[model samples]
Target chain A: MATVAAPGTQAYARPALLDWLTTVDHKKLGILYLYFTMFFFAVGGILALLVRTQLAVADSSFVSNNAYNQIFTMHASAMLFLFIIPVWAGFGNYLVPLQIGAADMAFPRINALSFWLLPPAGILMFAGFLVEGGSANAGWTAYSPLAQQSGSGMDLWIISVIILGVSSTIGAANFMVTMFRMRAPGMTMFRMPIFCWTMLVTAVLQLLATPVLAAALTMLFIDRNFGGAFFDPNTGGNAILWQNIFWFYSHPAVYIMILPGMGIISEIIPVFSRKPLFGYKAFVFATMAIGGLGFSVWAHHMFTTGAVLLPFFSFMTFLIGVPTGVKIFNWLGTMWRGSITFTTPMLFGIGFVSMFLIGGINGMFSAVVPIDFAIHDTYFVVAHIHYVLFGGSVMAVFGGFYYWFPKIWGRKLNETLGKWHFGLMLIGFNLAFFPMHLLGLDGMPRRIATYSESGWEALNFASTVGSFLIGVSMIPFLIAVVAAFMRPKDQPDDPWEANTLEWGTTSPPPVYNFDELPEVRSERPLFDRRHPDLAGGGH
Target chain B: MAAIESSPRHEEGMSNGMLGFILFLASEVMFFGGLFAAYFIARADAQEWPPVNLLTEEQIAAGVQLEMHVGLPAIATAILITSSIVIQWAEFQIKKGNQAGLIWGLFITLAMGVIFLAMQMYDYAQLDFGAGDTIYGTTFYTLTGFHGAHVFGGAVFILIVLLRALGGQFSAQRHEAVRACSIYWHFVDVVWIALFTILYIVPE
Candidate 1:
């Protein structure tokens, strides 16, 4: 083994510290991925607080106009690239092999390579701040012309993003091959767990969409360094061309960020409701439909640029809402008239459903051409993305943490602390972001350092206070994690009476995952194993 | 100890490694796909075939033509195609358990790949225009340049596979590396052909 890391292995006679650094074990890598992404998660949150504090008052002098650009741009770059996108890779890494009854990922060494690529890329990206011009100030979108005008920091950001894209692309191939080939004998496609299914589709999206981003970044790099005019209008190149290629990848990137979150909530909803996923096949097809439609809606983000065919992109954008809506309804259907519990994971599952509904509706608001013209770059657009990403993706990430914490760590987070974390986050999240809708409608532009003494001060203040509250919500979560670590590894395999195969093993499975295998007669192999009489008959 | 009780390797299909390489190739196709889209967009926005209007008089007078000179590139493309065929033949030799054929085939393919890259370099030096001269030069160089990079990567990959083949590491039952290398080399060849057609054969 090239890596010396070992989490659940006793056979290897290496020190515990060295085991972690060089370990290629999927579970260890997964935990490393989580730790790395969450650190950036906190970093991004701090950046967000800085942004909100500056925007809290009109003519706020908290940050200079130039400093504000770096803060906000790095904020988004950290959250999307460092945190949300890779977090699913983290979850999928830990869970997919266990769920599929495979010993490890299809390519274990490549899995390590995928993970190790991240730290350097992240450092290279954030290292931009230490450079002369500060970090990439052109926003995460990094539209050219502006992208060209930034200093070496922009080049660093470009290279780092391309490296990150390479990580996910190969990581996507690993996931696809693992799920496709490694399932236990009886586990067919439909019988795979919902989380695994969602991952499969998300991997497909990452595989196809991420490379386009790499290509665009390369072009931008050329334009900056090699005097290429891929997007320079002075050289007969269309400025909109940058947006066209960027959104071609990024629009699908939206789904890449959220689909696994949807998958997590789907799992939590069904398990807590004590039922099968409502319309499981329909749900699967809906996820697939979302992946397919995700490709067509890239132009929607470009609608306001006026170079796009607004109707086609608008129609495609609204059409994507259909599959997403179907998934939402399926979650509801799983909960309808079934036994339901509001454990921390369930609370988040429910939060994901409700918040994503709002996200969907607000997203629709921007899909309409005239409405987009009004809200195009406004706080409303800001509100829409936060609702979808923070409300949608971040909510499910915590739910996943709570849901899988016992299984991964072999100990439980304090439930009350978990509840407090969830409640504060929900309130703080809504407080911080919900007001942006009103502020956006009132004509406050996003990415601006300050506003005049207009009537927007109050809402901005509320949003700022809310952003802090969201930050404060992390206190309980930190406590819960620290407290959980103080406990013994006493969790049984099926702590929550869960139905999937992951719960069939020890709380933390052994080095090679399963000691013995269970028969994969249904999607819920463990559930069926527990109740042979109800096998294949129970919902 | 197998450690695992149920046989995960019992599945009947393409090996996971092969499938993964194919998917990786899929991403490669999309990467090229994005570059191609940029090319067409650049072309669409331009006034003429080579977009010489955007070039300065000094650049034109200095003998920079956005229209590619195809003679040497044509020879390089043929060499690249021949390399692809030789690598596939190497795979067939391994499948027939003929190590000698496999070794000789890989050697020939490696030689062809080097020659092709050398010829491509010569062609680039012989060109009247550099990558920075205009959008035409930009798209031309970016597309072919990326393709050239892929060919370089493919050559390194083949060298590794060839080393393994020489090390007595492959047989009829186990030459996945050779197959993967062939698939990648073929992809690089196909991409070059597409580059040659669009940048050289197609008119404004």
Candidate 2:
């Protein structure tokens, strides 16, 4: 067990490794999630570096084709499954209960169970590299025919993913129940924090979508091991069936990955701008609308598959943009007429909006079926993915870390270092991904180990440099984190003058989050507490 | 501190336990829904039932036939449906403070559930096809296999409740576990009925 010295007193008995492994405290579990997901983030980042290094020069032999396939597949798998998807759970596990003023999550033991499932599942998924035929090389999508060609690693990937899906599905139900039943006295559904609303919708998506992924993986498992023919074309099975089921779950999964990041941005933007979230109810409805539309537009990914209904999926894909546009404008509107502070969190929040816009607009281009036909397997799609995930989701993740670091750890990270990290990341991000759009437009395909076209060399080289820059940008962020840990814990509770219930407690909150919460007459309970004279009548 | 205990955090409208169970059931529905979707796709894509042409020519010549017998499985379905009724009876008896009747009802239901499972295993052994046979065999076995596993889970749940009932752990107002078990038993029963109808009764 790790122990921390009590300040100006004897050493305190703190939770150690075994305590973390067995504890059901939402705070401890949340910390575990943060540590675990960030570790995977670093791992996935290294894999990304390996990929960029391989692609630094044309016809470079830094790694074999098979190795590149494994590298990129593992990269996407680690990022999507390990880092981005679960990181929200990390934040939600910590903040949702605090934000809603509950004692803990609805099912704290199940919450522990959910957290514990990840390590074993993640280890199993990655352990495939040590197996006979190299790790799963079917891309993260692991499309049929190609997916069936791999060895025991494919089996390991399928089983690990199914286990991970179960972990997420159970965790989703926990979040839903916690939000629905555990709000503080006057915290009505509409008055609930925007982050809570987003978590609720994200939970619903996880509950419905993850099991379908589990089922698809199950069928694939049987097909591989038991001679079942769910994806085999030679055995009276339809190969397109795999695409349909995979996308059905994965399209909603896209929301599961990003919506919580949007939630984090929503929280940070309102707090830093010194205002209430503009159109709170509209944001809630937009989130719900996005979750709903997310399910219908999955076939958009199937546009180039030739097995989907192009017109219907295209229209539905376009329709999702409406609610997303609502969120974008709502964010901008929040910052429109306010005392804005460009804290590191705010910069990342604003970065999410601008970058996600490009991602959304480019996604719309894919919905124009003819355009999709051209860019379907090209680096343009790769650029769009990173823009949405890295530019949007990764930025929000850092924003969330900066915003909540004080509250969670009870110390302030160096502001200057944070800004440096944010600037480097933003510049490095665009430099890395932006040129791929042009390279893809010029007909360079994705997932290949090397290309013969020397014409594409300069841009590829530039992209590699940017990728390494993004890698280097993490140093300042890591140093900032370490420096924050080294400092004494003296942050005041409401460092950002945050609006929600989480701010009503201590900097590092007590085991039970609050001694007594403020009166929640509105969504901005803390704000209302700060200015009681204007509480009931304020706009 | 006194006020904190009486706060609205503890005053939720539903029991967290029951709500959690219901939400868990919802995910189970989607899991089963995926298998059903696969079955529908395979059926829609097929020009024939059982898909015998999918087998190799030599194997076909050697009389490796495929068939689904509904008669015995129909009996098993009846038995499962009866167990669902008996479990509900057990819940009603406990609600009325008739612990003796509750015990008997659970005993009967548990017996019926075990018999249904035994009959299923026997039926699987008797079938002319396996999961490896064809798309038809694959879909059939996968759907029924998962449903059977759920039934086994529900039976274990019932056995735990039955032991608890015998130990006099539940009263009229304190039978949440018993009620949860019944809900799960009914769900498993309903799934089996759907599986029986789709896998056995439906014609090509």
- The candidate that achieves the highest lDDT relative to the unseen native structure: 1
Q: Give the CA lDDT, 0 to 100, for residue A211 in model 2.
A: 95
Docking class for model 2 is medium
**Cα miss at A171, model 1 (Å)?**
0.6
Model 2: CA > 4 A from native: A1-15, A537-539, B1-13
lDDT of 2 by residue, A94-185 (tens): 99999999999999999999999999889988999999888899999999999999978888899889888988999999999999888889
> Global lDDT of each model?
0.90, 0.89
For model 2, report DockQ: 0.78
lDDT of 1 by residue, B48-124 (tens): 87887888888878887776777888888889898888889989998888999999999899899889888888888
